[model samples]
Target: MLTLNQIKNNPEELIKKLSVRNKDFSQLIHDAIKTDNKRKEIQSSLDATLEQSNKIAKSIGQLFKEGKQAEAGKAKSEAAELKEKAKELTAKLNDAKAELQTILFEIPNIPHPSVPAGKTDADNAEIRAGGTIPKLSKKVPHWELADTYDLIDFELGNKITGAGFPVYKGKGAKLQRALIAFFLDEADKAGFTEIMPPLVINEASGFGTGQLPDKEGQMYQVTEDKLFLIPTAEVPVTNLYRDVILKEDDFPIKMTAYSSCFRREAGSYGKDVRGLNRLHQFDKVEIVQIQHPDKSYETLDEMVAYVESLVQKLELPYRIVRLCGGDLGFTSALTYDFEVYSAGQDKWLEVSSVSNFETFQANRLKLRFKKVGEKQTQPAHTLNGSALALPRIVAALLENNYTEEGIKIPEVLQKFTNFDLIN
Candidate 1:
């Protein structure tokens, strides 16, 4: 969430930045300022009443001390009236604060200046691409390959847990484990501390990472416990620092985690969601960073490069694209998506997204850093990316690496899988 100072300093400028998201926020801005003013008024009135009441009580004590009972009684009555007024004002102030918070929640983060103005992914600008798209002798998608090799039991998964939940068997399960281990080892080599975060999170955790209220409809909720199944490791991993104040030296904090992510993926269908293209449950390795504001963009570049390296190691053909304003996530100021060419599907599949939130999430989390020798603290920038998500990466790998003999494993992962090919 944006801070009050940020909204007040240059509301017009903020409105212009937000307009790139293709919505009018002039009214929300106006309402925030207006509500803040009302809150201030109520606070002032409450303060004055409390002060006056204190003085009356002191004078009433003096009156009684002087043996003047009638004047003391009158003063007490006046004090009671002031107390009631203060109570009313206090309630109004609380209401105003709540109203202001609700308005702020409705407003999405302001897009970074580099964000291209566009309506969809089609409008996103390509940054760069790499690797060669393999010319397969047999262009078989992962699902068909899964059946041919008895690797994944889609029907068994459907019978047990419905569609979108796949049961990996034999080499398919080994491949999943190998990828997770390979990604984690690479992240560890990249100076990221590995953390095993909870698979479920509370409401505050969701809000801390800018997921709740905004994406609640797309999350699996445990209504009885008021907990939500984390849509990504990013949520619990990032929320670990909620309400924490770090020293300046804590800048460039990097952490990584491999978790089983769950998402409702509601209303998704068609060929796009087929097989391993999209899933309700999947494995992913997420990298999160909390960096000083001045160096966050640099860190974002590093993170993007790091993700690029992972796909490269997997021997997958990949491209990077800068998300346009309308396609950007609600909390991200700028984002870069990584897509791998799926030879079988004859299309590109998104395998990762690296983003810089630029204090948007920090403000909500109260995650701040204190400057050396300074009394004040300020919000730090938050960033996270999928070093690599398994399903699509698997989709691309299985499709692109298909051979007449067997599905060839990339050399980098062969050590983990303990074999070179899955036949």
Candidate 2:
């Protein structure tokens, strides 16, 4: 959520930036300004009335102590009228504040100045590409390769649960476990503390990470309990420091977590859902960092480099793209999506997304840090990224490393998988 001061200072500038994301902020921006003005007016009135009531009550008490009964009664009547006015003004102030909060919640984070003005993914700028796409002797999609090698059981997953939930079998299950461990290990080596958070979270946690309201249809909500299954480890990991105030020395707090993410994937259908491209449930290791406002962009670059290193170690063909304004997630000021080449599928599969949310999430979470010698608390910058998501990474591994003899495991993962190849 943006501060009222920020909105007041640059309402037009912010609105123009949000317009790049296709957001219609004219009414919301106007409403927010009006609500904030009304709230301030009501608050001023309530404070004045309360002050007058307190002063009159004190005078009434003094009059009674002096045995001045007639004067005390008049003073008491005046106090009662002031009290009633204060009460009415208080209610109006509360209503205005609530309305202002509603308007603020609807306003999205302003895009980073570097964010390109565009409407879709097609407008995203490619930062760099790495490794070479392997030339397959015989083209075979990951789904076909899974069936041939008895790696994953999509049909069994359907029979047990439903579509979009596939079961990893044999080497595939072991490979998935290996990948999770590998990702956590890689993240830990890069200074991220590993955490295991609850898969279910309350509404505050959801809204704190910007997953509620807008992405309501994308999550699996437990209606009876009013909790939601987390869509990414980012939601829970970032919320760990919610409502917390840290010292300036704690500027960069990094954390990583492995979780089975749940998404409703509503309205998604057809060929796009095939194989590991899209799924209802998928395993992923996410890295989150809380940094000082000044250091956030540098930390973002470091995070992107870290993810790129992991892909390089695995020898996967990948590229980084600076997401266009409209392609960026709602809460992220800037985003870089990493896509791995899938040989058989003849496409680049998105394996990770590293984003710098700046103060947008911290403002919502009330996550702040106090500088040395400073009494005031300021919102910290928050960032998160998928070190790697499993299904598609697994898809890339199988399709890219496919050989006539077997599927050659990436060298870095061989020790974890305990076998060099799945024949």
Query: RMSD of each candidate?
Result: 1.8, 1.6
Please write out the lDDT profile of model 2 over residues 1-423, one tens digit for every residue: 788887889888878878878777978988999999999899988888888888888888898899999999998888888888888998898899888988888888888999988889999999999999998898799999999999999999999999999999999999999999999999999989999999999999998998876788899999999999999999999999999999999878999999999999999998788988899999999999999999999999999999999899999999999999889887889999999999999999999999999999999999999999999999999999999899999999999999999999999999899999999
Give the Å shift of residue 17 in candidate 2: 2.4
Model 1, poorest ten-residue lDDT window? 209-218
Give the TM-scores of the predictions, in the order they appear.
Answer: 0.96, 0.96
Candidate 1 lDDT score relative to the true structure: 0.93
Off by over 4 Å in 2: 58-72
- Encode model 1's per-residue lDDT on 1-423: one tens digit a residue: 888888999999999999888788999998999999998889888899999999999999899999999999999999999999988998999999999999989888889999999999999999999999999878999999989988888899899998989999999999999999999999999999999999999999999998887789889999999999999999999999999999999888999999999999999999988999889999999999999999999999999999999989898999999999889988899999999999998999999999999999999999999999999999999999998899998888888999998999999999999989888
**TM-score (C-alpha) between model 1 and the true structure:** 0.96
- Cα deviation of 248, candidate 1, in Å: 0.7
Question: What C-alpha lDDT do the candidate models reach, one value each?
Answer: 0.93, 0.92
